[model samples]
Target: MKTTLSTTFGLLMLSAAVMASATEMPVVKPLRGTVESVSNNTLTFTNRAGAQQTIGLTDKTGFVEVSKADIDSIKADSFVGSAAIPQADGSLKALEVTVFESSLKGSGEGHYGWQNADGSTGTMTNGTVGKLSKANGRTLTVNYKGGEKQLVVPDDVPIAYVEPGKKDALIKGAKIVAFPAGDGKNARGVAIGKDGFQPPM
Candidate 1:
């Protein structure tokens, strides 16, 4: 009995070490928050409510920072989300767009009708790209979240993409979207942004 207990405890300790070393990805939830530290290839950050998290990164882990782009850069089948205002003709005119990183392909895939800052009707949607149009600036359809919407992506729509950046970008004061790991309790970070260019988390 003594030997068996010892073995069991040893196994538990080993499992804990592995979990602390590198986190896993499950369904990809947002791990948005501020940074705490970066060591052993693991990023320690805090959530909006001030809860600290430690997530390790492997070679396959994605570390991308936001960069500027235009509406034309959006492509079909790309995972994206946007905040837009409703037009008179019943089309959403994009105000801001963010192209999600590959690790967050299906994260929070849905359509949300939100209120605009100016009291206008705003729609927030995230899903896979479907089609694009060149008439009237550009019209786009994103098919996911069990729904679809035709959006007028203006040529001047502010767009951002997660381009590859240095690992050090995950430093303190950095904002990141950490995907939930297999455990569903702790999170694993994949993409991050710095200098106030935050992802739509």
Candidate 2:
């Protein structure tokens, strides 16, 4: 009876060890990061630990750590790795990036002091005008005086104008006059004329 009990305990210990090993394995996902360095198909990255580790991009490997879907849509000949920081969730957050090519460039106009979806403020440049629109969450949906269009603006993009009008007054049930920044451009801005009409603000 003692020998039989010993064998059963040994089996249970082996099963527990296998289960622990399985649970400790890291899950692989398509991740993009700025390439610290690259050799062949292997790229190194500064992980959340501040230590650099190399990863092999195989058929099973997903893309690296890009937040913007537009940036992720970009195709590249070579992989660029960047450092990743940890998020509240266990997912890796990108700190820096190395891109192989320039992504699509576009601009739009909207409220100069408009609040962004990410709680940032929109800054308009002086004497420069682009079509204005309300950002639909993170998506750039411009609502110009004329019409609406989907625009993609870069993080480094600069706005050209910051009007001094009240936010509520600008959109109050008033007629909006929109004209392109140039004779041939689609750029436009909304303005309430002083024709006996009071804007909401």
Model 1: per-residue Cα lDDT over 1-201, one tens digit each: 333332322222123233433433111224567788888777788877778877766553445577666676788888777777777987777887777656556544566553333444456676788897687567789887567888877777678875445567877887776654446344333456658666543
Clashes of 2: 25
- Candidate 2 regions off by >4 Å? 1-34, 69-201
lDDT of each: 0.62, 0.26
Q: What TM-score number comes out for model 1?
A: 0.52
Number of residue pairs clashing in candidate 1, backbone atoms closer than 3 angstroms, sequence gap of 3 or more or interchain:
1
Task: Give me the candidate number with maximum TM-score.
Answer: 1
What is the Cα-based lDDT of residue 45 in candidate 2?
47
Clashing pairs in 1: 31-178
lDDT of 2 by residue, 1-201 (tens): 333332322221122223322434211111112235445644444433346555443322211111222343222221222223333543322322222111201112111222222333332111111332324311233333444333333333221111223213322223222211222122122223233231111
